[model samples]
Target: MTQAVAKEPAARPRRGPDRYVPFTEHMGVVRERAAAGEAVFSLELREELLNNHGRGHGGVVMTLLDCAMAHAALSRVNYEREVVTVDMHIAFMGPSTGKLVATGRVTGGGRSVCFCEASIVDASGDVAAQAMGTFRYRDAA
Candidate 1:
């Protein structure tokens, strides 16, 4: 008897993978989940995403953080609004050996910009990376 390989279902499309203007084209990062106006982004550990120690790459981590923070900021805005990253800083704590996910949310908000943070955890739920960011709001319709 031959075993059949099961395929996963396609994701529902709502918006562009990258909502930020500058990083819009870099859909290289994947948005695995989104709900409650929040987003969870993930990516498989690959050689390109590995550092000298064969762990999660810093650039990859930064990208994830930026996307997560941006999504979080956008979520806080009024109807049909956008935002731009003003300042972002990420601190890498440990190595991520497998698939990684970043959960992001807005910590503070105002008329101009919002403050956001995201925690990038490994499959084991260990905090591998974290980021703090600020975003400038765009005009809303």
Candidate 2:
């Protein structure tokens, strides 16, 4: 037997993912682009988002990565469903300065789960953080 696949959303003007996520909005995280099994998000380092050393706070980094990875998982299903991070492990490389970009890709998984990896690079193109995560799919409605 085979399972049915989800339908994709209607096409729209080229921009960020056509969705409004309150937390992402509150943190100023923008979904720059998304495709099947891939997604990229970005955020500007603000005073409140920075740690004492003038780098992005750990919470900020983690949230950005989680969002990006979970989106990647959702995209694999044509975004017909939502995904939640079941487990995630992140490594902070060094100070993240200027605008930061996080890119996520679906490594592997089955229908109900996805494995993803993401990395954050600063404006200077230095890697500031990397993460691996597991996400489980759920109904969008």
Candidate 3:
């Protein structure tokens, strides 16, 4: 005699603005809707994302900051316009564990360029990293 084994269903891919962006989707970033000039993003830390010290990788933290700041710059412009990072400076405050939450806001900008800042906080509510970025907006054809 044999008995059937139950299997768990596969997890569904997240859907939203993040899904539309290939890199964001690959990174499993969740985009939280926010008012103009602001954006929020979140990511779950996995073993693969850890550094040698068992903390979140610096590259991952930088990517999160870049994405968040870019999103913030985009928020202040027309949705059809594209924004590209011109310069970014990041400071890692401390190691991070568990889920990472990032928030970004546009500080200032002109018609063609914008300045933005972002901060990442760990699940424990400790700030893990912060960044300031300059982005240029490309007009749509």
Candidate 4:
């Protein structure tokens, strides 16, 4: 299937010094409902986000996982600051199609590091991919 994330992409290069979610002219990949650290971001999937075989690209899946993981990690923090991804492991279970939603929750919290896990679901409500990640609270550093 062709899984595409069709939200207006940020003008910033994917790999750049300003990697901490650049503010975009458009709502871009990041939105309010998805920013509260509790809600999920739903992106419409299309062929552009597909792989060689036309399946959901691993990069897109990983990005979604990372975003969700950050949200989950942020839920444990009381203050606002950047949280760097320490580690992230994702397991692709099924092909992602249509609207892809990702939800994250904190598994554990600490003074220095936080552990979180998130799952990406397809339109059919099946988990297309799951992620477990650890993040270091920027302010805590």
Best candidate according to TM-score: 2
**Can you give the TM-score per candidate against the true fold?**
0.75, 0.85, 0.83, 0.73
Q: Residue-wise lDDT of candidate 3 within 1-141, one digit each (tens)?
A: 999999985565332233266576677778775458898989998988889999999988888888788878777773556788999999999999999999999999898999999999999999999999999988754
User: On a 0 to 100 scale, what is the lDDT of residue 47 in model 3?
Assistant: 89
List of clashing residue pairs for candidate 4: 4-45, 4-46
TM-score, ranked from best to worst: 2, 3, 1, 4
Model 4 Cα displacement at 1 (Å)? 48
- Flag the better candidate by TM-score, 1 or 2: 2
Q: Output the worst ten-in-a-row residue range by lDDT, candidate 4.
A: 23-32
Per residue, candidate 4 scores C-alpha lDDT tens digits across 1-141 of 989888985565332222345432122344334333453655666777778876678888788777767765665553355588999989999988777888877788677788888888888889999988898887633
Clashing pairs in model 3, backbone N/Cα/C closer than 3 A? none
- CA lDDT of every candidate: 0.76, 0.88, 0.83, 0.70
Cα error, candidate 4, residue 99 (Å) = 1.0
Candidate 1's residue-wise lDDT over 65-85, tens digit each? Answer: 888887777666532566778
User: In candidate 1, residue 125 scores what lDDT?
Assistant: 81
Ranking by lDDT: 2, 3, 1, 4
- Please list the Cα RMSD from the true structure of every candidate, rounded to 1 decimal place: 7.4, 11.2, 5.8, 9.0
lDDT of 3: 0.83
Question: Per-residue CA lDDT of candidate 2, range 82-110, in tens?
Answer: 77789999999988988999999999999
Q: Give the TM-score of candidate 2.
A: 0.85
